[model samples]
Target: MGGEIKQIFEILETNARATPEQISTMTGIPAAEVEKTIKKAEKERTILKYKTAINWSKLGEEQVWALIEVKVVPQRGVGFDAIAERIYRFPEARSVYLVSGTYDLAILVVGKTMQEVALFVAEKLAPLETVQGTVTHFLLKRYKEDGEILEGEEGIKRLPVSP
Candidate 1:
């Protein structure tokens, strides 16, 4: 990507609600060019979706989040892709990734309660033919998510200087 295009991507990534005109103003690019570039990016799947991150805990609607580590035996022809596709299709799965670690796949799942998340894992996730085992770790608290601080003030962190 050219500098202008990459700059546009960064600006949009920071604030998805930024209009093409706003981005053009910041980058000193023409608004029409910015709009055309954005349009092309969207068509090519470079710009996938604009999303909002909410801290639902503040609104008294807390969601139970779980990180499940899955060990799977890759299929002969398709390897892990087939099993990964199956895992990601579940509604409970918030994010699925093929990780480089002891586990084959890492899945982030969300539900109303702990039992609900456990039920999904028990009834849906762990039952796959290629799935060998699963280890689930429930999220107790979230201080930061998607580069945004969910609690306290968003400020620079530094150690106190002593001379």
Candidate 2:
């Protein structure tokens, strides 16, 4: 890839809402070329989807999220692909990834309530044949998500005490 195209990708990745004109201004590339590059990237699936980093807590919506560390036995020939696919097929599994360390896979799951997530683990996840073990950690709070800070950066200002 050309340096210009790579720069375009980096700019878009950081902020998907960036317009071609804006990118052109930032990168000093022609506006038409910027548009053309972005379109090509979309067609090639390099740019999957544009998203907004939402602060759900501000909305006062109750959302329970969990990160499940799974230990699975890799299938012969297929390795971890088959097992990972099977787990990801469930609608509750938001994101599934084959990872290193002690765990074979890491799954991000969401639910309406804590009980619902617990039920999903006991009833659905644990019973899977390929699943050797799992450790689930409930997300209590999100300080930062998708490189966006949820809380505003404002430190308390204090007046020094007079001696």
Candidate 3:
């Protein structure tokens, strides 16, 4: 990648929704150049979709999330991809990762209530033939998400420094 491309990617990674004009100003590149670079990155799949972060807790809806460790038996002919595809079909599953630990997959799931999440695990996840076992851990609270602090502005306050 070109130096300009790398710089553009770094800026975009830091703030995905940054306007091309802002990027041009920050990186000292022309606005048209920034726009071209962003388009190229999108075409190359280096830049995914831009999205807004939301505080689900502030919306009067309880945010309950879980990390489910799934151990799966790869089918005789099929591979991990097949099993992964099946797991990703559930709307409750927010993210899925193939891991190197004892578990074959680590799935992040979110639900409105504890019971609803449990039902998903019991009725949907466990019944899959490929899935042998699963351990679910409900997140009590989140301190951060995607590098942004979620615990409000209190914890990050800086005290006065003496010279």
Question: Top model by lDDT, which number?
Answer: 1
lDDT of each: 0.93, 0.90, 0.89
Ranked by TM-score, the better of candidates 2 and 3 is 2
**CA error at residue 149 for candidate 1, angstroms:** 1.5
**lDDT for each residue of candidate 3 in 9-107, tens digit (9 for 90 to 100):** 887777887899998888789999899988987898877777788888888788689999999998767778899999999899999999998999999
The digit string of per-residue lDDT tens for model 2 on 46-158 reads 88988877777679889999999999999999999998988899999999999999999999999999999999989999899999999999998878776767798577687
**TM-score, cand. 2 vs. native:** 0.86
Q: Estimate the TM-score of every prediction.
A: 0.92, 0.86, 0.85
Q: Whose TM-score is greatest here?
A: 1
For model 3, name the residue pairs that clash: none
On residues 1-163, what C-alpha lDDT tens digit does candidate 1 reach at each position? Answer: 7887789999999899999889989999999999999899899999999888888998999699999999999999999999999989998999999999899999999999999999999999999999999999999998889888888965767768857
The alpha-carbon deviation from the true structure for residue 96 of candidate 2, after best TM-score superposition, in angstroms, is: 1.5
- TM-score result, candidate 3: 0.85
| Reference-based lDDT, residue 13, model 3 | 78
- Residue 131 of model 3 has an lDDT of 91
Best-to-worst order by TM-score is 1, 2, 3
